[model samples]
Target chain A: MNAGQKSARRIAASNGPIPRDTVCFSCLHRLTHPSRRPASTAAALAESPPIPSHQQRHTNPPVTTAKAPRKAYQLLASPVLSRPPLLTRDLTSFEKAYYLYQKRLNERLALPFTRYFYYKKGTPGDAEWKRKIKVRKTPARDIGVYAAYGDEGWNDEVLVGDRTAERESVVEALVRDAEGKAIIDEEVVGDENKDGLAVAGDSKTGEGQRRDLTKVEVERPVGRVTEADTANDMRSLSRKMDRTLYLLVKNREGRWRFPQDRVYGRENLHQAAERILVQGFGIDMNTWIVGNHPIGHHQMNYTSGGAPAPRLAKITPNRLVSTSRDRAEYEQEEYGEKVFFMKGRMMTGQADIGKNEYGDSEFRWLVKEEVEEAVTGGYWKSVKDMLAER
Target chain B: MALLQEVTSTFLRRFKAPPASLHRKWASHCRHASTGAVAQETDELEQSSFLQGEGPAQQAIERFDPAGVAKRRNRRLPPSRYQFRSPRYYRGPLHPHQPPRPSEPSSREFAPGPFSLPRLEQTYHDTLASDYMVLAYAHLPPGQTAFKKGERLRRWEGDSPYFKNRPLRGPRGGDTLRLLRKPVTFRNVPQLQRVTVHTMSSDAINSGAALHVSGMVLQAITNVRAEAHEVKKSVAGFGVRAGMYLSLTCELKGEDMYHFLSKLVDVVMPKMKDWPGVKGSSGDFSGNIALGLKAEEVALFPEMEVNYDMCVRYYLSPTFRIWLLANS
Candidate 1:
């Protein structure tokens, strides 16, 4: 057995009779031994001065000893749950111009349209298509360098006006006109009904008109900017359409940080993170922890009597022996706390933090840059690399 | 530029040739013309004169109706006259005409599509990939020595004369060398390489029906053709004879692999009666994971469910072994 375990056994033997309700000597031995502690505690011990083999007996205490070992640092699991971008990032003006130029070049180089393949001969639809093509007035297919300088080429001279301006296609314009007319007809019908007049002929004529075969019906795409974006609503998940949004909450101390909770008894970091989400935001938001491991970590030392404790430096064996007289004072120092941040993805739903639950706390969905500004300098330095650039 | 120069030079030469030589070339071209001799003559005449009057050709073009032509002629049109047929076998690079690569549409072994991008693939590209890189990262302080690993192959240490020039021994406990895992970066994130679905049925040795059924079921579910493998050596305990076709395997890649995985995870696995999950210890140390499916579980697939009666008639109960390999 190691020196710590042997010392614990010797102490227990000298103490003689133990209470029945209390923990057995073996359990106490396991808890008191530094070698038997968890990996995190073992790592902490590795950085501290090693106790001389002869001093091992005095370092540990028996059951009758009033003072217990220094309390382990409190661990907190902070989960940074985020929503991925809904839309692709906006294109720059240069990109827009380049794409348009490439598109026009593609059209010029493409094969000549074979009208017979798409439309039958002598039909009204074909006639309409022919008229539309005539209006477009595309140049005929030609060979050699002359084609590059032709009127249809993607040249600065040909496109002297605003090059990147979005021009409505023929089909889009036709669709828009049809929708406008329908809306106007509806308004007219509503007015006639209010006046108690029967305009049957006009309604019949409007309904009798057939949809244009050559004109395609295109649905206008939804706008990228939402109400949340316009109002600058930091609480809304839909505010940023093209950037990753992280959920940050204000703690009782009024510090802005990621949603976090203390690591409870016998629970791992990821499990504590899962519990933190449900307790802080209720059982509504659907968030998934990416993995069991922590993505980043931050450590803070507690202040003692209004002054920060001296930072611990690596102590050599010779130096440790020389200062053995002050070992008691060194052992009593508190190491403060460590927070392990776990990465997660918020698939759906929002954080519903009840006022009574969190005690006047608030939550905001912030992007990378805003998060950096919201948290402290040290906190941002620790987590800046973990956040996605976009 | 050289190709363009060659083309222009050849064209100028052909254009400036003597009348006698031009006539000779035309005669040779007509000789090579197969069934379109008349059409070729018409095309030459059209090229000779760019301007023409309002003739019968213009009237015929105006009157042309494809639907009427198709209705009047009730038979299917003849096969395309000059359609290229890719070479069946690859001769060599030195051959006059080599076969096209399998990626080309005309190649004999070409397999098309990736017709649609799978949702899982899109999610991987957007999120999982970067997260994985960050999770696998390990930071080291400046001026620190890198971690050194012990030598894998053992060296001879004895002073014997025979040991002086001997080769290093294989790793302890096993002859196989384990794959080295490099630090994950943006370019080297782990990704699914391919999936292999394998099944061996001893019943196939006794009857060919079992083999046929297994092949059909595998192809139906995986969207890839299954290849039958014959037993090289007989195993008495397994009750198989040499040279008997006893196994079928289907390898899926790209779109097919994603579709199969998504379907299995989203639909089939959840429908199973009592499956917990693929065990945590299912993967080989080298990054390939295997999962087995019972006969009933195999039947849970949507493709098999559609033709459940047909599969039941043949008693399709071969256990499926699926292996998912990842590129690290």
Candidate 2:
């Protein structure tokens, strides 16, 4: 072989390959000697470190056990379905007082009312409005001058405005005039019948009808507290308006935990969780699983002293194990159970455990605090971090 | 005039008259009247007929009826001339009359929406955020320090004179530094920030029709106005010339981004023919993921389907590139 061909072969052996055009001795020298190379080329050569033995093993086939492996643990997919709070949390007394103070300050600094623009002159409605304003006796404009300087206008107490007085809603206020006249007419008729004085009652009715024009019957707002809250109904989803409620079911073993079902056949965890929801609670509810992945997992190890009582046999009867002999064999073979909890959300509908195909089971919709109290200490420790404080 | 007098007399009677002595005492203590020129002016003030209760100005206001005015003129009254118009361009901060921010109602760029919170957003807040935190948590026993990865940039090894004060070298393999995966917490939960819809049409260089169609389709799908981008460099192979508008891009944020994603995932993607789902290997190491859609797949969107004939020209079709960015 020629010198050029010999040098090219040597370069190829060291650096994988070289271009056909770069087969000259000078090119071979540049490729082989690091001192003669550019800074970038030298740096690139130094960058790659030798791969560790652990990583190198990835290229080889995986090792298989010579002996048969121990029986796998039973896998369960538990869906922790919850309902988010419907209403904002109740305001504290301090928050209420601070908001009221800010409102009063805003009113004091507001521009003077433009009465002429809103109320036309010589109109009965306008006259009635003016009369109502006269009774209020609020300053035309305070501009905080009185509050700041302690003038005669300052009362040395919380500034009381017309808003402090119980005011009817706009709808009630608008219909008040018509309703007031009817009420006065009824009262006048009653007075005339009782006293046998029609002539005197006729004059009194005219005055009363004019005076009661602004009177309105206001309906009180519905209270935030629901019947479920007062009754302490743990089964009702609507019990807590301002808290996230989780669904915890009591298994046949009388243990409180999230509704879970064993993985059947080749079904995945997500599909298993969905099946558990449908089996534990009837299909009347609308629910959605957040994702395919499990949020958390808890492993319960079975003691080697044989199967610790079969909880599944009591719940699923013949469906899971078929016969007593099969049940005993299945229980003894399984090492333990691993429960993977998937997050889910309930939009509507309540749990109908009684109508569920998975036999009779008691269920409760509980807040975070109540859930901690209802569950066992070990189960609580495993799940407490996942539950929302609110 | 008679009606006005009668209204004033009724008002006076309805308001109880204060005691004469008390009224005088209160008037004498009035702060404004106690001032310099105002005190002298009060003594000369005369009760003119025009200044009486329900004056001529008040009467004019009572007679001012917008409906009647419009009827007399035989046309609707013009909109109020005092309505504010936001400036189209914002001057520098030192300008006397500065333009309001884009978030302000008066700003020209103010686009208000998010009329209702999205279901996906609600789900993220209610469950997903906390679930992510729980799943990503790594327990460290008390007094134990976290194991950190080795420095990405190489430090000079040899004590050469030139290397004494020199900066560290760039990252080993390449100059690009990867984003660190910080432990997930309540404050640093991953969240979708915005979505960018982009389309490039080589056919646009020959005819503007391709560019226009792409822009319109992107706007319809994203609910945002598409901006045309000029080619920065000329390429002979692609038949694109520098300064030619051959691509369209639209950015969606907040409500628009969520709505677009939901529509794409729930409606369009499932209906796509022979779809293999987004490739698992499609994301940048950072939090951004990009997916490409053929012209046929873009046409499957409900918006384009509704007006199929208007935008379904196969020759003018443009492939779409969608980028989803998440802030970690």
Candidate 3:
């Protein structure tokens, strides 16, 4: 037979249980509506009946012709749809939520994340030193900054694209571009390392506030960050393996949402922080503040010149000790000789993302830098000073 | 990217394909025909049932019975069967357990080889369409009757026995069942696997969309007469009925609920064409898929409820595996 006929025969031969015509007949016989209502369709399928499927064989042979069904009569004499060992299956709520996400989220469009184990250095008080990380700060650091994107109820009161969250306004989350190099630069405004940075929330909450919020955490080297030392020298660093840059999107409900992979990493990181404070010189002489820190936070940040910085991008400090103990120990071991470790007063901070800055639509904060000279010129005393300027 | 593995094309490639143990070699065979034992049993049953079904044919054949049922069969029959039962039911000296005993070689060119397929225990089916497609559902109008299998499809002058004067065909069962165009060869070694059955309705089937069914039962029926026999083993001697299949499947799934009936009407029944001799299309079913895993994790169920008057009907679809890959 020619290939077409050969294939047709093969198909027909391979088709088990029923003759090809019967299947064709069953298809049309079961058709509640003609696939396409060609004027000739009714004429074509006139002999067919609608074959309903479900449960058990409700009615076998929905239609019978004088020709009779000589095909699978043996099938007709068989058992009803029920077979033995009935199916049992179950799913949980979170699993159901994951399934819901899986259903609606297109795999192709799905961006994912991965995490590795390692500890970070410093206490929540470290944010003050994290920005001054010896690691060369670049324009990229400014990209994720949103000055107004602080913890003060910004998330609840305003939504995405709010006038305040708009790029054009003073309330907008903005970062100084290369052209405006002097905006956040220590050389232009004048300030001490890590000293000017403060949590953006109620003053009381700001105490360890930066440790409570959800933010992108890029591990960097912490040359020697002690809970006593603020983040005066933390630098956001990236490793070749650390290619993931979490971009939290907003769900329809206007809540910041990340994929499960990202969430897993964030949660793990939170549980991996240490509450002990490093004893040493900080913002001023005798401040001697105790602060929460990821023990190995120092290694998480580094200098662009490849040198290890003293801190990294501020992450929510984990108060629960066991989860963050490895990190705490790693940092303590790495810099234990240089700094003294001590427990501090609620070294934790209130850094959760809130609607205080922008209305509750989806939004990401972009940190900007003042002109490189902003700090060296001694123009700003604290992050409040910087916020007040704009 | 290259394929993780490949199977060469050749005859002995599957069996003697090496590294495979002698036991496996012996176990993995498709017999040419059911053994004389199975044949004897099935034939006796088939004869009794056939005789009980239609009397005239049996009377005509009885006159020639002097040679006996087995001996007089093949020799006296016409060379080909145009409007008669298949001779496949005959035992012809082969074991049903082995997929196929090597067929006796023939001199004819391109002679079809043995029926070397595995035991028809469990099978999967899928559509062969290559383009992106969807399932749709529709219902018959208020006054018009549902389209009949052999009757011509009637036009709705926007009128009908349907409440909406519309004719609605259910979801993608035809396409789902279409996958059975070729029965797949799976292990007959008795392993667990999930068989997904999708249920969809008329409007959904017509809309050209994949139906989504969740938290509902799914079932499927392929044209397997041997499967019927397998089901009959339970009652041992009682006559097999279409209804028995459901309970058998439900029992296998470990569910005591009348899933077969629910699954049949809720899922499989709506998509099935009427089988001959069966009366009502909507009744308790005794069958459902013996799923190996939670369908939600592996497959999706079609969910679409049409509300027209206060009444609502659900739609389910068939679980299809062999889809026409778009890239192909």
Clashes of 1: 0
Question: Compared with the true structure, what per-residue lDDT tens digits does model 3 show for residues B1-328?
Answer: 1332343444346666367676767766543222212323234343465546643555564454432444545654453542222234335557442223223111112222111111112111111110001111122335444443432333444445574656644333352211111111221212223232322222322332222221122221221111111223333344333323322121122121223224333563345444242334422221212222222222222222211111122333323221111110
Candidate 1 local lDDT, A56-119, one digit each (tens): 5554544453253333454678998989877656544444454444434544544565455335
Q: Candidates' TM-scores? A: 0.47, 0.44, 0.16
Chain A vs. true chain A, TM-score per candidate? 0.62, 0.59, 0.14
Q: DockQ scores for all the models shown?
A: 0.05, 0.02, 0.01
lDDT of 2 by residue, A1-390 (tens): 234433553544442344433354344554455377656545544675654566433422222322332245667899999888765554433344444344334344334554553446776546655543432333222112123222222232233232221223222332432332211112344333211122333565564333332344555445668999999999998889877899999887888999987766445677778878887888888998766778778888666466463233222232432332332223323556889998888888888897655553799999887898889987887787667755
Local distance difference test scores for all models: 0.66, 0.64, 0.26
In the range B1-328, model 1's lDDT, one tens digit per residue, is: 9999999999899778486776788786664322212323244454433435434575676666554555678776565653567777778889877888776655676644434446667656767787787677665545433455668888988988988879998888899877788877778898889999999876786788888888878987997889989889988987877888889999999878989998898889999997889999899766689999998999999978856766667867577999999888
**True C-alpha contacts between chains kept, each model in order:** 0.08, 0.03, 0.00
Top model by TM-score, which number? 1
Instruction: State residue A175's C-alpha deviation in candidate 1, in Å.
Output: 27
Candidate 2 lands at a TM-score of 0.44
Please list, in the order the candidates appear, how each scores on TM-score for chain B only.
Answer: 0.68, 0.67, 0.14
